[model samples]
Target: MAASPTTGRGRPDSLDHMIRLTSLTRRYGRTTAVHDLTLTVRSGHVTGFLGPNGAGKSTTLRMILGLTAPTSGTVTVDGVRFRDRPRGLRHVGALLDAADVQGGRGAEAHLRALARSNGIPRSRVDATLREVGLAGVARRRVGGFSLGMRQRLGIAAALLGDPPVVLFDEPFNGLDPEGVRWVRGLFRELAGQGRTVFVSSHLMSEMEHCVDRLVVIGRGRLLADQSLAEFAATSGGSTVSVRTPQEGALTARLTAEGGVVRAEDDGTVTVTGLSAARVGDLAAAHRIPVHELVTRTPSLEQAFMALTATSVEHRAGEVAR
Candidate 1:
C-alpha cells in the first residue's frame, strides 16, 4: 500500500486510497456542526479520529458518506463526491451506529437488504457474516441479539460490499476482549491490504495500540491532523529510566549534561530531555554500572487532553452539583 502525501490540492494517482475533506463546514441553524475542516485520510494505515463529546465527529462522518449535506465546502472519497457515486457501498463501507438496524429483521435478512440496495451480490451476505463470526446466528432476530452481536452484524453489513474505504465510529463500544482483538487485527489487515481504514474512537488506549495516525477535532474544528508518533511527541519526548549504584555521581553527570534527572521511589532515576541511548552512553563514558536502562513512551491520553482542553464542549468538572 502506498502512503500518499498530504498535498494541499489536486487528486493524485492515489485516488483509490484517499478520503479528502476541503473547507467542509456544516451549520444547523445557529449551531455550526463542522467548520472549515480540511484533511486527508490516506491509505496504508489505520487513522483514528478523536474528539470529546459534541465535537462533530459523527456529523463529519455523515458528510463524508453524503448522509448530511455540508453547508459549505466539500468532502470526497476517491476524488469524487459520495453523492455523485451511485451504489455507494461499493466505494465506502461504514459502521456509524450499530443500533441503527431494524430490530425486527433477521441478521442475514438485514445484510441482504443492504446488499440489494447497493446492488451487491447475495453471495457477499453469507461471506461477510462468516467473516464477522455471525454466520452461526445468521437467522437470529436483530432485536434478540446482544450489543456485541449487533455490532458484529453491523460490521458484516459494512463489509458486504468489500469496499476499499472502511470507516468505523466507536467500534469498541460493545465489544468483548476477543471481539476487540479481532476488530483491531481486522483494521490493520484492511490497511495492510491498501484499504483506507478510518476509525472514530474514544478508547485512547485502544487507539494507541491499533492506529499509527490521528485526526483530532474539537468544537467542529480541526485541531490536529498528524501521525500518532508526531501527535504524541507534541507533549514532549520519552523519559529514560536508569538504575545505577552511583546515584549522586550519575545524577550530577546527567544534570551537568543538560538532562533533567528525577529521583524515583523505586531506587532508580528517571532522566528526561534525553533519550535512553544518550543516558547509556553517558553512563558508559563515566564508568557507571547501570543495572536498568529503559525508555518510557509518552501517554496519548495526556497529550490529547492537553491539546483539546479548551475545545471540550461538555466539561464534566464544570457541571452544576
Candidate 2:
C-alpha cells in the first residue's frame, strides 16, 4: 500500500481544538487503569502515544473517544465531550480497535452502513476504501480478510467522515514490513495535511519515523511531551571512545581531568562527559600513544531507554495503577 492522499487544509481552526484531556483517569474497581493523565492532540502534526503493555495507553484513548468514562478528569473534543451531541462523532474520526469490525458484513457493506448512520454520503465510502488501499477487497466478507486488511478497512471506516481529527490505536499491529512502511507514509501524509493525527503504538522505532512529536507515558503519567530534537537534546551527551596502546596511561590521564573512563575488554577506553578532541589534547600533552579517538552519540532508542529505565523498573509487575 502507498501513502494516503494529503489534505493540506484538513483541520479548520475555527472549529476548535480536535481533542483535549485534562487530569483524565480511569479506575477498574480497586485498580487504576489510567492515573491523572493529561495530554493534548494538536492539529498539523502526528503525535505518537507510547507505553508498554498494561501501561494505560488503551485506557486513556478509550476515555478520549468517550467509550469508557474517565473516573475523575475531563476529555473534551472541539470543546465538547462526544456524549454531549447527537452527532458528536462528526468532528472527529477514530479507529480504536481493529477487531471491532462486523465479521458478518462485507467490507463495503459495513462501511456503507456506518456511513449511512453517520449521515455521510455513500460516495464517501468508495473514496475512503480507495484511500486505505482496500478498494480491491471492499466487497469481500470481513470474516475472510486478514488482520492487515482488516486494519486497513478500519482506517478506511475512520476516514469515511472526512473528519478533521483522526485517532488510531495500535494501527500497525499484524502488518507486514511493507504494510508497516505503507502505514508510516500514510501517517506522515496525513499530518502534512494539517489534521490532528494521533496514533498509539508500543513500537518506538516505528514512532520515531511516523510522528512529529511524542507524548510518552510510563506508569500512566506523561514522561515527555516534546519534539524529536528536544527529546534528544535533553537525553544527554555522547560517549567518547579512545583507542590507545597505552590504555592505563590514557585512562589515568582521563580520570585525572575529572573524566570517568571505563576500560573495555577490547583495550579501548570509554570516557564520559568529555569530548574526543579534549581527550586527544590531554593524551598529546601526556605523550600517550592514541590510535583512534571518536565520539558516538546515543541513538533515540538508547536515550529513551536510559531516561525511562527507572520508570520501567518501578512499573514491572505492578499492572499499571
* Candidate models: Cα lDDT each: 0.87, 0.80
lDDT by residue for model 1 over 1-321, one digit each (tens)?
A: 111122111122342579999999999999998999999999888999999999999999999999999999999988899889779888889999999989999999999998999999888887787778887888889999899988888777777788888899989888889889888888887887788999999999999999989999999999999999999887546788899999999999899999999999999999998888888988899898999998886789988998888888877768586
TM-score of each: 0.89, 0.85
Q: Assess candidate 1 and give its TM-score to the true structure.
A: 0.89
| Tens digit of per-residue lDDT, candidate 2, span 94-115 | 8888889879889999989888
Show where candidate 1 strays beyond 4 Å.
1-15, 319-321
Candidate 1 global CA lDDT score: 0.87
Question: Could you say which candidate leads in TM-score?
Answer: 1
**lDDT for predicted candidate 2 compared with the true structure:** 0.80
